[model samples]
Target chain A: MRFDVTILGSSSATPIYNRNPTAQALNINERFYLIDCGEGTQQQMLRYDIKSSRIDYIFISHLHGDHYLGLVGLLSSLNLNGRKKPITLFGPAHLKDIIQMHFEYSETTIQFDLEFRATDPSKSEIILDNQDITVETILLDHRIACTGFLFRQKRRLRKIIKERVEELQVPVEYYAVLKRGVDYFATNGQVYPNNELTTAAEEPRAYAYCSDTLYNESYFEQIAGVNLLYHEATFAHDMLDRANETHHTTALQAGEIAKITGAKKLLIGHFSARYKTLTDLLDEARSVFPETELAIEGKTFVIES
Target chain B: MRFDVTILGSSSATPIYNRNPTAQALNINERFYLIDCGEGTQQQMLRYDIKSSRIDYIFISHLHGDHYLGLVGLLSSLNLNGRKKPITLFGPAHLKDIIQMHFEYSETTIQFDLEFRATDPSKSEIILDNQDITVETILLDHRIACTGFLFRQKRRLRKIIKERVEELQVPVEYYAVLKRGVDYFATNGQVYPNNELTTAAEEPRAYAYCSDTLYNESYFEQIAGVNLLYHEATFAHDMLDRANETHHTTALQAGEIAKITGAKKLLIGHFSARYKTLTDLLDEARSVFPETELAIEGKTFVIES
Candidate 1:
């Protein structure tokens, strides 16, 4: 299975020239999960050719304008396009009221089913579960209530060896049992070992998203050993003091977290408007964690297990 | 005086991909007056190089999202940029409350003063008057209480013939009277005719903006003979029935209004998302009024007297 993450935006609180606000899209199998819809997110999605209709769920970190300002516009566009599928939105409780008031004032009634699920930003909890993937939230320290997410894909069954099964005189109907790691039994009470015909199942892949939070070690244990980790590094090491004062993480801090958590690869973004070029940020992060990569806009990074 | 009008966005209700919402920047001399800040208006301003700091006042047509969704974001950006000049906003009574609520909820105390003036959308009235320009609202027929605006530049001083003034032995202080089209009196009591020294001031330029309204001839009298007129054209001629039902105007209707009012030129926009190409819309409007032009994004149409 091919799983990947796409960066829609990488800017922090302020919008700059050619840099959009925070938004990302996770592609698991053939499905898409959108996260953190900032202003103009729908337009960015349109420009990147991401089918808006394929999005089944949206995960919002907080109520800041840069994190969720584009949500209402995206929903309005979806309704105008005649979307009928139900979309689940996970965010804070106040988000529902804000969205409702705007629609009420505009007298707009959406055509699709919208489900709002309030997430507690203080603790870790399972938010979504399916046969293919499981999503959980991890609390992070910030000025406001904020949470990160961990998405883990389920392991696939091992493939059976056709020649071995045939040499053992196994029937075609018994292939399901062999693929399930079970031994096939003959009618005469003869047994066939499962290890001879099948290999081990593939390991599950994991991806984590952390946005707009101060550097705190409490989340390291929860997201440890993630295959791909995306964390917001709003400032460089030179502004570490300012980052602490403003409840943001510096590039070095993000790299430290990635190092402590033993993540396979680190993706750092959510850049401040002051930095015109990201060369310093990449250099800072790479010095601490050699596997760190800059989250460039419109680029996709595949998660490999 | 160099006075011109630029159409930034011209979409109603919902904003489409290429078609932006309602926003226009009127430039008179060195000052800028922004009218109707729709969603993405600030981005449009940046795209066209319209200085946000030069905007002295903002006029909103109504409370519709397509008309005012961009106001909060724009104001926030201004605050982020540390703008100190007070921004005067003229709109309906409820707009102040809505903006206050958003600020209060976000715990943001604006750094600059925001002067709010309520306009009766149902009646025509003078909204703003300054040394360089005067603005008046014209009642528009829409599903909601909405109003359009007429911007007229104040008459400038007549040019003085330097050699003629020198020959008359007129004092420098008396040049003001000559520019104002008045006869100057010398110390010897000799009368200097105003026409010989100065010509008449250039005719004042005028531009009108009509947005999200149905075809109504009553507005024609108020905005008559405008140098440039921008009218909403939400649909093509074939959708005239639908346009009437939805309180919108077709391209033909916009051209008819321009022809009836004897406007010098007509600019048509506010396209429906259903149409991918605007060639037919331009053709339809030009068929009725030959001087009609389509409102292209980032293009400025100067209002010449």
Candidate 2:
């Protein structure tokens, strides 16, 4: 199964010089999840050829305009396009009011079910769990209510050795139990060890997205050991003062977070518009975390275990 | 003085296929007036190189998402850029509530003043009358409370003939009165005719913008003889039934309105996503009104009297 993230937009606050605001598309085993849909996210999706219908869940990190401004428009467009599947939205408590107010004033009746789950910014909460993955919200430090999301793939069952099972004459009904690591007891009172019948499955992988937050270590333990980490690097190390004043993370700070969380790879984005080039920020990040990479738009980053 | 309009966005309803939604920037003597800022309008402005700081007045035709969805983002971006100049907003009464609700939830403090004028969609009203122009709202036929905007340039003063005035020995103090069409009286008790002292000023120009509306003639007299008229043509003549059902205008209907109102030129836009190419709609409009033109994005149309 494919597990990758596509960058839709990377600009911070304002979309300037052709760089769009914060938005990313995460594909976990073909199901899509959108994170931080800023303005022009729909267009960005179109530009990148990402189908909106595949997106079943949307996670908004904060109420900031750069983080969630594109949500209403995206929802409206989905309704217009005759989307009927229910969509799960995870965000702050006030997001429901904002979306409802827009629909009320415009007299627009949404054509699909919108399931909303409000996230608490003060604690780590499990927002969703499915057969494919489990999603948890990690509280982050920001000017307003903001939280990051952690996606961990579900553990797969052990793969049964078909040759060993057939040679041992294991019944078809007992195949599923064998895959679950249970010993097989034949009708003739013969016992078969699970380890001899099956092999271990691949390890589950995890990815975390952190954006529009200050350099705080509150959520470090929650997202520790993530395979892939996307953190907002809105400023360079030289502009650390501005980053603190605005409650945003600098490139160096983002690198430190990756190092502390023991993330295998760090993907940094939410670049400030002042930096026409991002080499300085990337270098600053790499100085701390050698596995850091810039989150370039339209590029997909795969998470590996 | 410059009297031109730059088409920032021309698509209707939702943005699609690289064509943006409805948005236009009118430059009247270097002052910018924004009409119907749809989604991605600020980015459109940047793409067309239209400065947002010059926009002092914004007129929203209705509460439809395609017409006003970009307003909050644009306003927030302006504030973020340290804009301190007050901007006048003309829209529905509920717009202030929506904007305030967003600010309250986001905890954002605007750096500039946003003066709002509630427009009554049921009747024609004079929304603004400044020294440079007079803005009047024209009631439109739509599913929601919608209105069109009519912008008329304020009459200019007659130009004074400096050489004629010097030869005629007119006092410097009388120059102002002479430009107001008053006869100049010299110290010798001889009256110089106002016609000979100065030339008549150019006729005032007018432009009208109508979007998300149906075929209606209620504002015919109000927008008659406008130099430039931009009407929404969301459908072609063949799709007249759909246009009527959606309370939108067809290309032929829009052209008929321009012709009936005696507008010097007609610009048709707000094209539906169904139209991959606008040749059919443009041909239909041109067949009705010979002076019709398509409202192409990034193209500027000059209005002359």
Candidate 3:
């Protein structure tokens, strides 16, 4: 399972100091899913070689301009470049109206099918279920309605050890049965136990993306034990009052969230424009959680099984 | 008087090959007027050190996504940066609705006074009249209701020759009258002619910005004898048929327009994505008009006085 994420933009409300607004690309099994496209997402996508046509799913966190302003331009470019495949968009209900108004004012009828699925921000539910994974929405506490996404990969069946199978002289036709945890029968009327010949598959890899919200423990258990966690640390720990007033989390709180959720690895981004150097913020997060890293733009972070 | 136009983006329809879509900044006497903000205009402004707070005037040519998609994002950024100065926006009437919808969905009240003046694409009208210059709409032929802009500089007072004034024993009080094209009267019963004492001021400079449009002679007379003319050359001469179908102008046609309009200099841009190096397009346009230049991004062209 090739599960990795690339940070597109790392700024919070304003894109300053060479930092862009919030946006990211999650590649799951060679499929790209855009998360929270900001104003310059299309250019960033081009900069990072993330093909817009390859993105079949887009998840918008909320209605803030920094989160979804680049959507219309990306869609227009996709149409201009002659995108034939359908693209599904998941966001709040008002986002659909915004898209419609842009198309209406521009006097353009979209050439591709743009399916809109409204995400429920008030409760947690399974929004997407496919053969590879099940995506569930995690309710978030924010100034506006927002939701985080938990991508849980499906567990695969047991794997057969190739050396053991060859040593036992197992027939090629019985390889499938061996992987299904069945005992292999030998020509000498002896049985080879499946547990001795095969090994259990690696644990399913999972990733959680938490966009923007204040510190809250309500949805922590749903994302517990995630292999990789991305959380927004819009401000430093000293600005906790300001973060509380604006319904945003601080770097200290982001680390606390990772600690409470038992996230194996933590990536913190969405830094406020007030600070040019993020050394203090990173140290604040690392003070509590050891496996913490800054979500630098255009850097890819992989999830290990 | 200082007047120059800087190209921010030059690509047409799509932003590719490290080229951006349509956008430019006109500096008139130190005041910045943003013209046709494309998708990444805000970032471009930031890259080139064009402060958003200094942009009090914005002119959007049409409602096409490539032409005005960056307007909302720019406005939001200005607001976020605590812009107390008011701004005047001129574009198609529906553009106001788009801005309103974006603000409404974001649940934000604009801190500055955003005044939107609708442009009438059917006829030529003076939309802005200030002491420095006058901006008029030039009706264009396009699929949508599109209009170009004609910036005409107001004539300044005559300049007095310091040596001539001193030699003629002209009184300091008579300097103002002499600049008004009147002869200076000496207390000793001598008269100094205005032409000999003060030479006529330099010719008022004018610039014409022709956005996406097909070749037409209807608005040529209005932009006649412009000091600098910026026209869209979306495709090469070989794509004439396609240009006509799309209501866009070719490089040859743009050169022809500049020649017939008696423009002092021509700057051709808005190149199609098919073109990587614009040498061929530049040569094609230069074949017809000798004083032709490419609207290279981040370069400023001064209008000679």
Stronger candidate by DockQ (2 vs 3) = 2
Expressed as tens digits, the lDDT of each residue in B199-249 for candidate 1 is 888899898989879998888899999999999999998999999998899
Tens digits of lDDT, candidate 1, A1-305 = 76898888899877677778889999998788999988767767876888888999999998777888778878887887799999999997778877886777667788999999999976799999987799999798877788889999987787888788878777889888788889878777988788888887778989999988899888889999999999999999899898999889999989999999999999999999899999899999989998989889889999877
For candidate 2, write residues B18-135 as lDDT tens digits.
7887899999999999998888899899888999999999999998888888888899899999999999999999999989988999899998989999999778988899889999
How does each model score on TM-score?
Answer: 0.94, 0.96, 0.96
What candidate 2 gets wrong by more than 4 Å, as runs, is A161-169, A183-197, B185-193
What is each candidate's DockQ, to 2 decimals?
0.46, 0.70, 0.67
Native-to-model Cα distance after best TM-score fit, residue B157 in candidate 2, in Å: 0.9
Q: Which candidate should be chosen as best, given TM-score against the real structure?
A: 2
**Residue A220's C-alpha lDDT in candidate 1?**
89
Error of 2 at B52 (Å): 1.0
Model 3 has a DockQ score of 0.67
lDDT by residue for model 3 (B149-233), tens: 9998898899999999998778798889888899887888887778999899878999999988999999899999999999999
Model 3, A78: alpha-carbon shift in Å?
1.0
Q: TM-score of chain B, candidate 2? A: 0.98
Model 3: chain A TM-score against the true structure: 0.94
TM-score, candidate number 3: 0.96
lDDT per residue as tens, model 3, A187-241: 9999989888889877898889897899999989998999999999999999999
Q: Candidate 3, overall lDDT?
A: 0.91
